[model samples]
Target: MSKTLIVYGSTTGNTESVSDDIAKILEKNGHSVEIQDAADISVDGLADQFDTVLLGCSTWGEDEIELQDDFIPLFENLEQAALKGKKVAVFGCGDSSYEYFCGAVDVIEEKAGELGAVLLGESLKIDGDPEPEEVSAWTESIMTKM
Candidate 1:
């Protein structure tokens, strides 16, 4: 079984709800999974655990970083070269009418790429009210790759 980590930052709990669903599916598949809050995590603390990382967040105003207040500092503290070769994926919740749907996922994916982490699975861009089937499919696809 693959060891997986799901880190999420949600202001209104939408992203957290999604992460919970993903974690449940992964655990049901017999994979060891840990769900964490991005706000409380530190790069140093995550240095040596798990092989797969799933980041979830909501899109903030003006297409800016959703959980920038938390993730920004932690992300900046990491050594770019140190994160090379890591495997990661991103999923975000946003309102499609906001003009920047899933903008948080965009930022997460870009940063993960820059850190040299191999992108795994699709970058899930769930609408304001994401579809269960879609989220299930996303979870299934990631599990297959894992």
Candidate 2:
């Protein structure tokens, strides 16, 4: 069984709901999972001891890409998490109408890749409300790949 950690930042609870859904699915798939709010964690050693990490954050701002409030610090100092060689996945919520939909997931995936984290799959970009089926399907795909 793989051990996975889910960290998320949500302003209006969309991303949070998605994170919870993912955790449930992963658990149902027989993986050990831990979920944390980004506000409660620091970048240092954030990915340590976990076989995989799933990061989720909502995108804010109209023109510029603004990561969720609590995720800013983590994004700023992602290298400190020491994720080299670790498996990772990214997901987030955003409005499709926005120019940069789910931009935070892109940024995090890019940075984690730069820091040598192996991406498990393509990210989940939720436009508007999150649906459990979508989250479950995405997570099941990740479990297969993991």
lDDT, model 1, position 51:
79
TM-score of 1: 0.88
Collision count for each candidate, in order: 0, 0
Q: Which TM-score value belongs to model 2?
A: 0.97
lDDT of 2 at 136: 87
Give residue 78's error in model 2 in angstroms. 0.4
- Candidate 1 residue spans exceeding 4 A from truth: 45-47, 63-68, 78-82
Best by TM-score: 2
Candidate 1: pairs in clash:
none
lDDT of 2 by residue, 119-145 (tens): 998999999999888888898888887
Model 2 misplaced stretches (Cα beyond 4 Å): none
TM-score for each predicted model, relative to the true structure? 0.88, 0.97
